[model samples]
Target: MHGVRIETDRLILRPTAADDFDAWAECMADPEVNRFLGGPQPRAVAWRNFMTMAGCWSLQGFGMFSVIERSTGRWVGRLGPWHPEGWPGDEIGWGLMRDTWGKGYASEGAAATMDWAFDTLGWTQVIHSINPENHASIGVARKLGSTLLGPGKLPAPFEDDVVDLWGQTREQWFARRRR
Candidate 1:
């Protein structure tokens, strides 16, 4: 949580922190924002879920980064390399606050994390486990140059849900970045 940090044109990406909790909880509480993210969670539940992300960093050394706005130092969202136990693949996912929607923050932050996952983490590929109905995420994946990899599976709680996997190989990522 202390060492790794990513800065994009308008955002900073780093591990989740205690100070980010209230904003994180607020984002999780937004029904519209959480609509595709397993629904709004109560503060107590969100706390547990939030700790899961932090735990990943402690144990796995890499997890979703708590996104911050560069200009305002505001907690905007979380997005980055994530592959929890029983996960579908090495995924780069995102979930932002409702107020931050339509601002290109998701794609902007995701692009930086994709680079970190591939170049630093040495991942061969990365995927975005997007809900079929989550058009906004579909658009972000498309914007990142990932193509549909067909329907995918999620573990336990999300196993029955419809998720479309979108991804690109590291080779493809570098090729696209060259242009």
Candidate 2:
């Protein structure tokens, strides 16, 4: 079954669907957007990666959501809570198309995502795996009230790429929200 959907003032986020392949693939192929995310992948590779996110929903009950701009009904990218097998920690991550950058969509989606993760998923903490050179994402993390927690490594395929783990506990997130 398909996972639940989340709506914000300007966006609609839902579980990845097969029909989203085109927009999803395009996002993966954009070098500007894909620079720090394993580089621009071919359409074929994007398909496999696409399935992984969709599969995570069926197999794990949660994963990235295909974000859509409500005004245009355009699939922007994927963003949400994700914690796969062998993950370093629970995380609410994001990757928006280059065109969607600077619009506060990531920050908006992240706030809603973190709320769901903490209130519904019952997660006590969240971590963001960010490459050192990825300054854009680092800004987003800071906007979300996350700070570097030291170095960490991802599981296979990304094992060699060390990342800075940035995050905060659910208590911390809520406490930040109150202010």
Candidate 3:
């Protein structure tokens, strides 16, 4: 398999697998976790979404990673670079299982994903689409050194929803790292 794996000091960001279903379903099924991510979805819906992500890797060469805690060896969430057709931009996004909140995993995974996107994937820029009410994600974006770029909207199913595009260029990211 040509799956990609990125290791951080505390977590591993890798491609999704069939074995990841239960944990993925668990997280996706949580109302709190999905509050700003389009609301809680049924297991069947979660299965289709999970399969879509897996297919994205096979077709796009890059997509959301199944975030794993190094210590627990359990799935914590999914965070990484994504650029599906009709997306506002190349984005590095995240959604953790409610239990995984407040541990800084989002920032850790996002930083790694930004590094991989800018350096490995040769992407020059990355954005994060944050709902105005999603203060947590806004904080994470700030911690990652991304500033609010402007307003943006997601494609169908979420076309009516609004988002603040937060991001930095590859150069900006490197400069922040040098600090």
Candidate 4:
């Protein structure tokens, strides 16, 4: 398994731990955070989701990293790669507490994760699928230099709400890094 720890100017992206339950629950329960997630799930459901993420490292080799504020060493949210139930390929996903929004933490953490995915995992391309109406997440994709690939379907079991797929290839990432 990849025991990767990514660091940004103000955040440390590390593996999720048991102690993250409260923060994770808070973020997951926030209406703003779940606005595009089909509404806030209950605390119990959020805890289950956290466990699933913690287990993904063993099951998938790479999984979502909990975003922690370096200065406070507190969980801010989660950011990294994930493979949802029917996703065509590995996807990069991110979510931060509403209180932490608009501070560039999401972009910073995501950019760091993207660098790790390309340089360490050698992933040639990464996909980010977001609800069509989630403009905030769409902006994050653009900030990472990803291009909208138009409407796309995530495999079975997903709702009919079409998601916008954004992708960034290794070549594009390298070019951006060189800039």
Q: Least accurate stretch of 10 residues (summed lDDT) in model 4?
A: 152-161
Give the candidates in order of TM-score, highest first.
Answer: 1, 3, 2, 4
Once model 1 is optimally superposed onto the true structure by TM-score, how far is the C-alpha of residue 147 displaced, in angstroms?
0.4
The ten-residue window of minimal lDDT in model 1 covers: 1-10
Q: Which portions of model 1 miss their true places by more than 4 Å?
A: none
Query: Cα deviation in Å at residue 163, candidate 2?
Result: 0.8
Give the top-scoring candidate (lDDT): 1
- Number of the candidate with higher lDDT, 1 or 3: 1
Q: List the residue pairs that clash in candidate 3.
A: none
Query: TM-scores for all candidates?
Result: 0.98, 0.97, 0.98, 0.94
Worst 10 residues of 2 by lDDT: 1-10
Q: What is the per-residue lDDT of model 3 for residues 1-179, given as tens digits with 9 covering 90 to 100?
A: 23578999999999998899999999999999999888999999999999999988898888899999999999999999888789999999999999889999999999998999898889999999999899999999999999999999889978988799999999999999999
Per-residue lDDT for 70-172 in model 2, tens only? 9999999999989988889998889999988999999899989999889988999999999989988999999999999999889998898869999999999
Q: What is the C-alpha lDDT of each candidate?
A: 0.93, 0.92, 0.93, 0.86
lDDT of 1 by residue, 51-162 (tens): 9999989998899999999999999999998998898899999999988999999999999999999988899999999999999999999999999999999999888888
